[model samples]
Target: MELNRFYCGDAIKIMQTFSDNAIHLICADPPYNLGKDYGNTIDRKEWSAYETFTRDWLTQAIRVLRNDGTLYVFMGVRFIARLYAILENDFGLLFNGWITWHYTQGMGRIKGYSPRHEDVLYFTKSKDFTFNLDDIRIPQKYYRERNNMDGANPGDVWQFSHVHYSSKEREEHPTQKPEAVLERMIRASSNPGDIVLDPFVGSGTTCKVARDLGRRWIGIDVNPDYIAMSERRMAQTATLFDSFDPRLKRTPLDLPR
Candidate 1:
């Protein structure tokens, strides 16, 4: 089936139509089971049903991925245990890293130092997968100190924080991830013109970043609002996606202030 640039529909059903080995990467930001209002949040699910849901998507995603393709799933820190069980029991050796995106926010009024980071679970279909570490390195705060080491390869503790509170990228959606974060993943994981799939494309941030970086992207969102927001964001981006370059001056994405 010839999928268009973006689709506004149920992600599971839409994913079923895609061909095997077609997509290079599946970067999913599915519901976190936080029991809150996502654009069109599913009525909260029971534990068994939640596992079933994960299994269903994993089955379909694995089928569509090439041997070299990778699946990167972002979830809350609290979800690690259950999700890890699901990955181990169901997917076996395919599990890769329990990469932590260490951000600098999320502390509540309670006891501990707040929960700011997230888990970006990496699962490759096979041993041979695309992972170019050199391309995604953040500039060393102390470039002079590190003489030979290839920039600060922070390994999973991604030190970059979420978009700042005064950041312009903040959207109405509570769960919107920053574009800088997506930029790192898209760059380090896939090459230019690679097929990047974002199944839960809230506010189309992933698609926008993909487009701005010259990747061929397919974004599916359950909400029309998100789809519209993504399209507007694309239009806001001046260059045609085909001509985009990573070296272009990063136009700070506008957001609610």
Candidate 2:
């Protein structure tokens, strides 16, 4: 219920206390049901039980979201389609984009190809939503005379490196997201001083990025360790925030005209 702070509790229960249409943006990265250890909480759930959990939390998220608010949910391949159905068919939120987060390295497989991507479903509560395309634009591949000259629209498929265990930005959480990924979402969807909510704030990437960008944030996680982890990470980041998209280094090819 508090803004710009991390609350340790059940996401659904905590979210219920929020007033209606109070959130400008919601970035939810719930359990993928992969049986990963999350400290005091089990990631594994029965198929029906998982569906119920997903539906309930999503309902709360949608309730708190403003009419023009945007919601971006990170999901695994196992339940991506079902989640999409719940958002579009059941809830009727307008489908905005299906973003693919492509990483270079991941678990390799002998029987099949190694998985290198995760999907994020972007939806909006209504037709008109806040999307500052210029705010999120990445450097263009090549500069042209007729081009806007600002930057190019970062397409649906995004390339950001994983916060590797060796990296300093890596947190204790198993499925911690890259900070650059959340930064793009927050910058594009919400304005400065707007309230951004992360219901399942694992590792608190969303909240940290929101705060660094001058937006109000609320992050709730069931695990106390994660809350502490996020707090330490935020405290350490005063001037410079964590890592960024690797592609940001690419300078647009200059053309003589």
Candidate 3:
């Protein structure tokens, strides 16, 4: 079990090689079964086949997770409810939160309201899990003697713009996520030197952020091209994150003397 390495292979098979209770945190953004082109693979699968795939990978993911480990999975609306049930009822993972990632821009739909958000299901292997509130808190909205002043819990609804195609940090991957989103997860759920794993690494935002934050990481992706893309990004010098919570910049009103 090598740390800080990218394995270009099937996620389930790759995870099966890991020892049980080995991973401290996992941030996964698997395909949404929306028929997207992912170079060597297609995101489309029969409903039954997709469910089987989901269960298979999750079984391995849960096995590899430490007792105190946390998992955050990104999903589109179509299958989010099903995913939640599978995590809680079938796998017996403890539900921590249902996070809605609200983005300001997206493709328009004339037939219905445009989709503006994606869901991230947060779960833990057990009741006791790592969550560094101070590391992930947002600034207070108003000054008060009672306020913790350190910051406030970011809550379940997160606002981060998609990594725009024209941005220098953007990769060729179809669903590349903003670095700040992964940063928040890594910062909150795991401490420095803990092992972070991303089974469906995509463009590798999870691995990149984990490395930047001093954590050991493993990234698994089926596509060799994406492995190369991740490697390229990892080789670059670290910079300020591409996006962040707007609340981080807000000034508290009426400072107390």
Candidate 4:
């Protein structure tokens, strides 16, 4: 359960190597069916192929997750139904909450309210789940002089700052989630030293937050570019690249960082 892991190849193949009931959390943002080319493939991020890919990894992920653990997934609004169907029937996971995040800019046109939000679904393997509310509370808009309340509990609809296309944090990954967004999720659900697994690591923002918070982490993505970017981000944070053990080798070191 204690490991600093990053796998560079297919998520499904890499996830299989882990044992059952071992992980505390999983936060994944797989391909959004955006139809973008992966350099080698020409098919339109095929849903059938993606579905099978998800099923393969989810099977392993479910087995590796602890009973009271949590699974969080961020999905494009367009693909939520398909993704939810996959999770609901396969895992028997109970729906905990649907978190809505507002992004300042997006791809939609003026015709239909430009899509500016993404959905984050939180589900638990069983009815029993862990929630540390205090870890992610945001402040109230107006200051109250004598209010005994600590901070405003974040509403289901969260308005977080976004990483715009021109920002310095922008990496090679086109669909990278803002780091603040991942920060809140990690804070709300996990503690220092907890294991957080991210199956679609992309530019590794989730892993970066997990490491910054002193959590153990594992991330897997099919792209070598993503894996290398993840390692660099990890390195930039000064998170030691040493695997949890000397003998444990992560999958992306061979690629240039």
Candidate 5:
């Protein structure tokens, strides 16, 4: 229940204690039921059980979220559709966008296409939501006098490399997310001093990014090891973040004379 701290417990139970409409942003990366090992827990779950579990935690997330608060959930292809339906129809959360996280490489397949992308669902509790577009804009592809000089919207499809084993930011977790990806989400959805909640904080990417941006954050995970990992990871400060959307580095074209 404490702000800017990591709690080791069930996501739904921990969220139930938070004050209603208190959290300004909720960025959750729950288990994808992929049968992966996560120390004290396994990612696999019975289909019906998984659905119920998702609904329970999401219900609590919606409850603690402010009317203007935004929620971004990272999900795998298998459950993205069902989760979308739950968020849209069951919870009545307004659909903001469906984000595709494109990675350059992934598991290659002999019988089918290689998997290379993940999906994130963005929704808001109400129509009125906080979106600091400038905070998340990427470098424009071309220069035009009519275009906003600050930058351009990164758009729904984003490109961020995976936290591969060779990367320094890579943690022991099987599905660690890129920090820059979470950074963009936090920067766009919440303001300084606002409370950000991540009920299924896997590697603590959300909490760390929020902290660096001056937003208060709460992270919860059932695995004690993961909670510990988050604490250590969030403590370190660096001159630069690990990665960024490639569009941010592209050079804009020269303007007409």
Candidate 6:
């Protein structure tokens, strides 16, 4: 279990080698069983099989997480409820918040409402977990005395645009998440020099953000190509994040007269 390295293998198997309570934070974006193509593997599974897969990896994830550690899991609408139950009722992890990643643009559906958001389940191993409020705060919309002028808590609903296909920062991976999302999660949950782990590091967003934020990281992915993709992203430097919360640019109104 070397730090700041990517392992290409089964996530469950790789995590089994990790020492108990070794990871400070885990930001996982596992497959959603939506029949998407991930090059080497298809994101499709039977309902029962997917549930078992989810439980197996999560068991390993929880074992390697420190008592004061935090975990953020990205999942689609289909299985979010089931995931929540497993994390809380089944495993007894401390329920924290259920975040909504609202991407402005997405596939339109004629039969139903267009899908514009995904769910991120946040949990902590214990009540004494790390949470740097100021680290992930967004600017307030109004200049009120009651409000903390420093910044307001970026609430459960997060708004970050998807990396468009033509964007320079976009990777070849099908389900690539924006780096700013990971940036917020890492900043809020873990401190510098802490160990961050991503079991299903699809496009390496978690590892890259962890490295940039000065944390030790371990990324495990089954696809060798994706492992290489993550390596290339780590090597490159960026002046600005690919996406961000729109509220970050807002100016608080109603200044004192």
TM-score of each: 0.83, 0.95, 0.98, 0.84, 0.96, 0.98
* lDDT of candidate 3 over 1-257, digit per residue (tens): 79999999999999999999999999999999999899998799997899999999999999999999999999999899999999999999999999999999999999999999999999998999999999999999988989988988999999999999999899999999999999999999999999999999988899999999999999999999999999998998889999989999998798668
Q: Kindly give the stretch of ten consecutive residues in candidate 6 with the minimal lDDT sum.
A: 233-242
Candidate with top lDDT is 3
Candidate 1 residue 125 Cα shift, in angstroms, is 0.9
Q: Write down the worst ten-residue block by lDDT for model 5.
A: 238-247
Poorly placed runs, candidate 6 (over 4 Å):
255-257
> Lowest lDDT 10-mer window, candidate 1?
240-249
lDDT of 6 at 99: 99
Sort order, lDDT high to low:
3, 6, 2, 5, 4, 1
Model 1 misplacement above 4 A: 1-4, 111-113, 139-150, 164-166, 238-257
lDDT of 4: 0.75
CA shift at 157, candidate 6, in angstroms?
Answer: 0.4
What would you estimate as the lDDT of candidate 6? 0.94
Each model's number of backbone clashes? Answer: 0, 0, 0, 0, 0, 0
**Predicted structure 4, TM vs. truth:** 0.84
lDDT of 6 by residue, 99-208 (tens): 99999998899998999999999999899999999998889999998999999999999999999999989999999999999999999999999999999998898898
Error in Å for residue 203 of model 3: 1.2
- Writing each residue's lDDT as its tens digit, candidate 4 over 62-114 gives 88888988998898887788778777876788888889987665677867777
Candidate 1, overall lDDT? 0.73
As a TM-score, model 1 comes out at 0.83
Which residue runs of candidate 3 sit more than 4 Å off their true CA positions? 255-257
lDDT at 98, model 5: 98
Per-residue CA lDDT of model 1 for 19-122, tens digit only, reads 98888888888887768587576736886786687778777777777778888888876566787777667776388788787766665867766776788888
lDDT of each: 0.73, 0.91, 0.95, 0.75, 0.90, 0.94
